[model samples]
Target: MSTGYDYSWFILTQSIIKKEFALSGSEQNPDLTGKSWRMTLRRATNKGAPAPVEAFKSHGVDFIVRDRIEDLVAEMNKLAGNDLLKLEHIRMQIEARDREIVNPYVKDAQVMNIHNARRYIGDRLIRTAAPHRILDPAQGPLIAVKLNILTRKTLGGFETDLDSRVFGGEGSIIPGLYAVGEAAGFGGGGVHGYRSLEGTFLGGCLFSGRNAGRAAAKAVG
Candidate 1:
């Protein structure tokens, strides 16, 4: 319940937000990495929030990122004020594909587990002649962000900061607060954390969701 996130975490997020955020420019389409899209209103959003970059269009069906939808709706609704579109209507608008500038998917993970600091994230401050530290899409492809995450010690029988299993032991004590997929350490065999992986979040969500449903059913019974 009380996962103690320290002040450093706040500072880190602020620093990261500043570095990661971009100011959207008109005449240019936003292209989020995944099917995600979030844009400022046709009026006043300057921060370059990621948006879907049109290439996702295929025949009629298309993918939409949930994060983008939430963000775009919030921004537009801010402009709409009391006239905010109904959630259903908004859904209709979404299905209608109303966004102009958009981005695809984005990095949803709060952290990345690396094998070594210099090799993986790399020496950000001296990455290039341009004087770099993470890659920015605006700077072109091959974007990279060399992060130096805290290397917390793993004592085992608990969740590691990297969301890894430090050792095989009696797992989490969420108290019938079920967990599955990566939460319960799926496919992470032997390693303490995930060195590199993607889409685990979605898979984890599905696994956990199904369990929650089953638990609910059992409780009801």
Candidate 2:
């Protein structure tokens, strides 16, 4: 399943990895699941991400850690079994992005998005890192991850009537049976268009579930 956020080009620094990368899953985040604000605050301001993130960096096959970009690209190419990425090309992009931060009115969209996200007090304090050059050594060793595509949403499934009654093979409603969420195509799959934004599947799932629940309750009454 997709993690819902794209980190394909995300370059993590050794110093910020702990604070920047929070591994997915409930068990990976004791601070959050346990509702310990004090621990959470520590993680936010801390130099490291969570323990699980560190473990992945140390042992995960997809992770490439290097002191230099050239070496990093070499490892990446080796891992991918091809020389598709060029060191110079990647460096140029990093340099160009780094130059944008010098001006407050930079035209870079991604940088602008980061700035906008950090405008909120909460994001500024705990989420968004202060803008910095990627090549800066003070941030520590650079890290690249070979992100893999994950399948999550099922675009279409069993057909259903407006009330979420499942349609049988002969185009008839199956009595006392219903479907919802992804099974019902997320409210006929119209809540989100052809392409959905990151982390938006939940909205469709919740909406369809609510509709099915209401319909089932009404039928019973």
Candidate 3:
């Protein structure tokens, strides 16, 4: 769903349950449920390789590389063990996006966002890629990264007081019970309130931990 310079590109599949994830085997298999794959396709370059790509490579994560789009699509299908992604469908989408890039006025939200991000000097210099067609021969050979989603943190948690004391169902603090950091819901249960800015949770965790430590120390004293 997001794209950046050589370092960042993310695409989240739209439907949680789709035909792409359905395996040929029995539906009774527990492992088959809720399984899906996300892929990032980018132009291969010697320079400006994304840090994650390097790290992943060093850690032995497999990467698909091909000189031709057809070859790339074939590899992707081979890896997925399914013919979910059609070469023509992928080509059509890429060509459509490329066409918008050449247009003086673009209506694509993602392309517009990319342009908007580049207006900032920092993003322009390091975080955003120059708008280009992925199919451009000069940009090949292409790289495909298969991604897996991992749960990092919870946005919501136990409701707590400023001192990190856990609040009960009746809205009373439970004796000798406390929650801190993410357990205190990042910042007492509604600090993020359904959404949060990246890296802000660290601050909330630290602040809540500090409050809990002080409060516990004072109470014990």
TM-score: which candidate is best?
2
What tens-digit string does per-residue lDDT give for candidate 1 at 103-184? 2232322112111222533232211122122222332222112223453322222343222223234644443344444444
Alpha-carbon local distance difference test for all models: 0.32, 0.77, 0.61
TM-score of 1: 0.24
TM-scores of all candidate predictions against the true structure: 0.24, 0.73, 0.68
lDDT of 2 by residue, 1-221 (tens): 36543335456667556555766567888777889998788876666666688789989999988999889888888987878788999999888877996678898788898889889987777667778787888776889888876656677777888788899999999998888777777733456876765566678778777878999999999
Ten residues in sequence with the least summed lDDT for candidate 3: 11-20
Which one is best on lDDT?
A: 2
RMSD of each: 18.3, 5.1, 12.9
The C-alpha stretches of model 3 lying farther than 4 A from their native spots are 1-46, 50-52, 57-63, 187-189, 192-194
Q: Candidates ranked by lDDT, best first?
A: 2, 3, 1
Q: Model 2, 210: alpha-carbon shift in Å?
A: 10
lDDT of 3 by residue, 71-181 (tens): 878877787677877889888987887799777799888889978988986556444666767677665556665665455677677888888999999999997788988
